[model samples]
Target: MKTTIFTFHPDLKNGSRINASLAKAASEASFEVRDVYRLYPDFKIDVTAEQTVLEASDRIVLQFPIYWYQTPALLKQWFDAVLEYGWAYGSTGNALRGKEVLLVASFGAGAEDYQLDGRFHTTVEEVLKPIATIQYHTGLLFLEPFITTGTLNLSDEGLNEQVEKYLNILSAE
Candidate 1:
């Protein structure tokens, strides 16, 4: 399958650790990795180009670090711009129909932090409900998210292992 990973890390090269490594692994594994911030430093997203890329993909992966329980700014902008009224939803919007979507997110908090009785008092699934709604409305299949919790304190070995697991996930059918 032609899988495309749309990574939305603002300071990807310098600030990020896990996501940067995952991006490299995805690229090496032949999954098309589009670094949105790198491409649109000015935040001027070209809707046509974005749509073209999405149109050619069998699977679309939205990879990012969770920020205040929401997606980063550019990703939101991409969604607003690229997923137009008559292209991604509405009666005539069928471009993304039948496409599979996966969310790969890294959380600084541990898994326990995102539970009913945990620190945040909310599950990750609850946090991701809006995206699931989008998938439902747009006719995209929402796959189970690939999440890495406690990212703030991952060891080198653990990080490498996660990278390998990501590669495996991307390679899976």
Candidate 2:
């Protein structure tokens, strides 16, 4: 599949220990990764170019470090700007129909911290409901999301293992 990943980390250079590695692994594969912050530093989005990539892609991956349980500011702006009324949804919008949408997110909190009785008091799935809605409303196929939690304490070996699994997830049918 032709995959396009929209990576939304503003401090990628400083904070991409895990995500940056993943992006590197996918760099020459069947994927194209876009750094949203780098692309739109001025917050001026090119909706046409954005939509064009989305339309050409067979799979769409929104890769980011979940910020306060949501995407970073620039990606949010991209969504609001690119996913317009007559393109992504509404009467004449069918741009994303039959395509696939996925999210590959990294979280600072551990897995146990994202549950009903955990620190956040909600499952990661619960926190990700809005993205599910985007899939449902857009008539796109929703693949299982890739999530990495507790980034701070993972050893190099552990991190590489996770990256390997991530490659598998991307290659899986």
Candidate 3:
């Protein structure tokens, strides 16, 4: 199956260490990795091209570092521009049906920090609900997410573990 991982890191080169490694693993493995920030720095997304990519892939993976409890601005912009109502959704929009959607996100805080009594005061599920909602809207199958917590200070082993896990998640049937 063709899997496409849309990686949206604003500072992919200079930011978090995890995002880039994940991209590299997927890219070197010959999986499709769409670097959104690098592809559309001006926030101009080619809806047709994006739709083509999505249509061709059996699974769509959205990878990014959680920013302000949400995906980066460009990712949001890509959803707005590319996931059009009449195309990705709506009664006539069944192009993506039977496909799978996966979320592979990174969090700066520890996993505990996302619990009900933690600093963020919300569950990881709560923080990631919108992506599932998108899956619903698109008539796509929603898979469990591959999330890594405490990205601010992950050891080399921990980071590699995440990269391998992410690769596995996307690679699975």
Candidate 1 on 107-161: residue-level lDDT in tens?
A: 9889999999999999899888887899877899988899999999999998999
Rank by TM-score, highest first.
1, 3, 2
Error of 2 at 141 (Å): 1.2
lDDT of each: 0.91, 0.85, 0.88
Among all windows of ten consecutive residues in candidate 1, which has the lowest summed lDDT?
128-137
Give me the candidate number with maximum TM-score: 1
lDDT per residue for candidate 3 within 42-145, as digits (tens), equals 99898899999999999988998898898899888988988888888898877888898888889999999999999889988998898788877888998888
What lDDT does candidate 1 reach at residue 150? 91
- Model 2, 8-40: lDDT tens per residue? 888777887888888878775656889888888
For candidate 1, report its TM-score.
Answer: 0.97
Better of 2 and 3 by lDDT: 3
Between candidates 1 and 2, which one is better according to lDDT?
1
